[model samples]
Target: MKYQPIDSQLFIKNRKNFASKMKSNSLAVFNSNDIYPISADSTMPFQQHRDIFYLSGVDQEESVLVIFPDCPKANHREILFLKETNDHIAVWEGEKLTKEAALKTSGIKTVYWLKDMEKIMFELMTQCDTVYINTNEHYRANVETETREDRFTKWLKERYPAHQVAKSNPILQRLRSVKDPIEIDLMQKACNITEKGIRRLLNFIKPGIWEYEIEAELMHEFLRNRSKGFAYTPIVASGNNANVLHYIQNNQQCQAGELILLDVGAEYANYSSDLTRTIPVSGKYSERQKAVYNAVNRVKNEATKMLVPGTLWADYHVEVGKLMTSELLGLGLLDKADVQNENPDWPAYKKYFMHGTSHHIGLDTHDYGILTEPMQANMVFTVEPGIYIPDEGFGIRLEDDVVIQENGEPFNLMGSIPIEADEIEDIMNS
Candidate 1:
């Protein structure tokens, strides 16, 4: 891994919290993600399943974490089954985590090789009445391909048909939503790296530069700062291309007097930081562009304040919609008749700003948080609001990641990065 090692204490606390939530006499299992194949003898990089990474700090493939808090034997309470490292594997790949190293990395004392999983699991399953299986329950998830966890779940249920099945997604969705202090620190590091990348673009972006070139500059800054790369597919939409919400082609050449929307972020140690800044390709926004940019920034700031504890996710969006509507009226995009005759399902503001103002941000960019539940402290969210005007041939979006506090306004992680119209202009010219 390119990033620094995190203390295992965070993982220890995470496991304890998760175990406490499991049903009595239930054992929860987590599996690592598979190295996906691209073609003949070709494969994509292995990304550890975010759930397993959250519970145990294990960042390797063919690893399993079993938490049986009510196990008869104390040593069997927590066990990790890892791919056995041999001389051949060491020479071919690299050093896999040894028992001692796993202990240091995950705080799990009992470590077994992957081959012993059946025997060990059989012994443990005989004593437990219920088994917790992991599954994807994210609000935006629409997975078609079966994952490693899904395969293991099918096998587990067939092998132990008598055992009561429970879902680990419920517990993880709540726990991971409210981050620990250590997790917040890691996210801050990711955001700081994103700041460096965005600041670098201030000097590099100019007329006639290809959008992909800006992407390369950000990637270079991220790699040097110890980040693996972008948290998501970067959107370097320039000119009217920004009107497309999910535009990620990054193939257009930026022209002078046009606004380029950069929806980019840096991922440090698998923790994600989402940021979006629409800047002028000429290094200075024209009057109309500046007006729209400031309006979006204002909406982002107001939306962030609504992320405090006890706030409902759906209600928060409604409040943000109102703010955006007022801004749109002030910008002359909507009128009294538009507001009065607007559809309740899709308001007049949807014409310019259609997407939600914020989303949970942590391990995944659009991370796991139950929207129906009330907001809580330490939950990180990205406040992004945009105004797209196809007729004007430009679009503007501004975003910042914030952490909801216990008793005050949410803390802005990207506060150091320039967002003000004048400040961005000054930095670009400097």
Candidate 2:
């Protein structure tokens, strides 16, 4: 792993929180993600399942975390089953976590090899009345591939059909939504890396530079700063490419007087930071571009203020819709007819800003948080709003990650990054 070792107490606390939510005598299990295959003898990089990573702080493949908080044997309360590392594996791959190392990394005392799982699980299952199975329940989830957790769930059910089964997703959805102090610090580190990348692009971007070149600059900055790379697939859309929300083909040559809409961020310690900034390709925004940019900035600023404690996610977006609507009206994009005849389901603002104004950000770019619940303090969100006007040959989006507060407005994590139109222009030219 490129990142530093996190404090094991974060995982310890996370496990305790999750175990408290489980039914009495229930055992919850989480599996590491499989190292996916590409072609003959090739495999994609292994990304530890976020849930397992959250609970155990173990970032390796073929690992399992079993939390039987009410186990008869005290040592079986929190167990880690890691893939056995041998001389062959050490020579071929690298050093996998040994028992001592796992203890240091995870703060769990009992660690066994994967070969011992069946025997140990049988004993634990005999003592427990229920089993918790992990599943993907994110609102945006559309999984096609059967995961390792899925395979284990099938096996567990076949072996212990008499035991009551429960879902770990609901518990995880709530626990992971609220950020621990250590987790917030890791996220802040990610945001700081993203800020460095944005600042680098500010000075590097100029006329005739290709969009891909700008992306290269940001990548260089991220890698030098201890980040594994982008939190999500970067969107380095220049000029009209910004109109296409998910545009990632950053192959176009940026022309002078055009704006480059950069939706890019860096990941540190597996926490994500999401940032979007639209800057002038020529190092200066034109009159109309500045107007649109400031309007989007205004919308983002206002939307962030709504992310305080007890605010409903759905209602917050609706209020943000009104803010965007008024901005569009001021920008002359929507008229009285467009407003009056707008479908209530998809408002008039959808024409310019189609996506949700904000989403939970953490381990995943779109992190796990139940939208049905009211917002809570320490929950990180990205307040991004945009004006996509293909007719005008440019689109503008501004985004910043913020943490909801108990008292007042949410605290902007990306507050140090330049967002003001004048500030961006000055940095670019200087």
Candidate 3:
């Protein structure tokens, strides 16, 4: 990992909290993600399963974490199973964590090699009456590929058919939604890295520059700052491409008067920061562009204030839709009559500003949060509002990661990054 070692206390507390919520005589298991293959002899980069990392801080493949607070044997209560490390393996690949290193990485003292997993698990299964299985239940999830966690769940269920099965996703959704002080600091680090990437582009972006070139600049900054790179597939859409909400084909040339909607962010450790900023290709927004940009910024600012404790995620979007509708009406994109006659399912603002204004942001770009529940303090979210005008030949989006506060307004994690229309223009021109 490029990032520095995190204090093990965070993982320790996470495990304790999760264990407290588990049913008595139940054992919860979390598995590391698979190193997916791209083709023969090549593979996509390994990404540790966020659940395992959240509880154990084990950021490697072929690892397992088990939490059993009610175990008769104290040492077996919390355990880690890791791939055995050897000198030959270390010479071919990088050093895998030794038992001692695993203990330091995670706070769990009992570490076993993968070879002994079956034997240990068999003993554990006999002792525990219930098994908590981890599953992907995120609101935005549309997973088709069976994950390593899914395989483990299948195997465990087949092996221990009599054991009462319980889901760990619900508990995790609630627990991971609220941030720990340590986690908040880690996410802030990610946002800081993203800030560096954006500041670098302020001077680098110009007419005739390819969208991919801008993506490269951000990647360079993120790597130098100890970030693994983008938290999600980056969108460096220039001009009309911005109208496509998920645009990632960064091959277009940025024209002199067009706006580039940069939906990009950097990841530090395993935490994610999501940011979207629209900048002028020629280093200055035209009068019309400036008006649309400021309107989006105004919507983002107003939407962020609604992220305080007790706000429901669905209700918050409805309120944000109202703010966007007002902005669109002022921009002449929507008329008062359009809103009155608009379908309730598809608001009038949908014509210009479609996507949701905010989403939970941390570990995963679209992090885990139950939308039906009320917002809580320490929950991190992205306040992004965009205006896409295909007729006008440009799109504008402004986003920032914020922490829901106990008091008045949520704290902006990307507060240091320039967002104002004048500030962006000044930095680019200077």
Predicted structure with the largest lDDT when compared to the true one: 1
In order, how many clashes per candidate? Answer: 0, 0, 0
lDDT of 1 by residue, 217-322 (tens): 9999999999999999999999999999999999989999999999999999899999999998888989888888889888888888888999998998989999
Candidates' lDDT values, in order? 0.94, 0.92, 0.93
Report the C-alpha lDDT of model 3 over 63-97, residue by residue, as the tens digit. Answer: 99999999999999999999999999999999999
What is the lDDT, from 0 to 100, of the residue 113 in candidate 1? 97
TM-score-superior candidate, 1 or 2: 1
Error of 3 at 273 (Å): 0.7
Instruction: Tell me the lDDT of model 2 at 103.
Output: 95
lDDT-wise, the better of 2 and 3 is 3
| Ten contiguous residues with the weakest lDDT in model 1 | 297-306
**Clashes, model 2:** 0
Q: Looking at model 2, which ten-residue stretch has the lowest summed lDDT?
A: 198-207
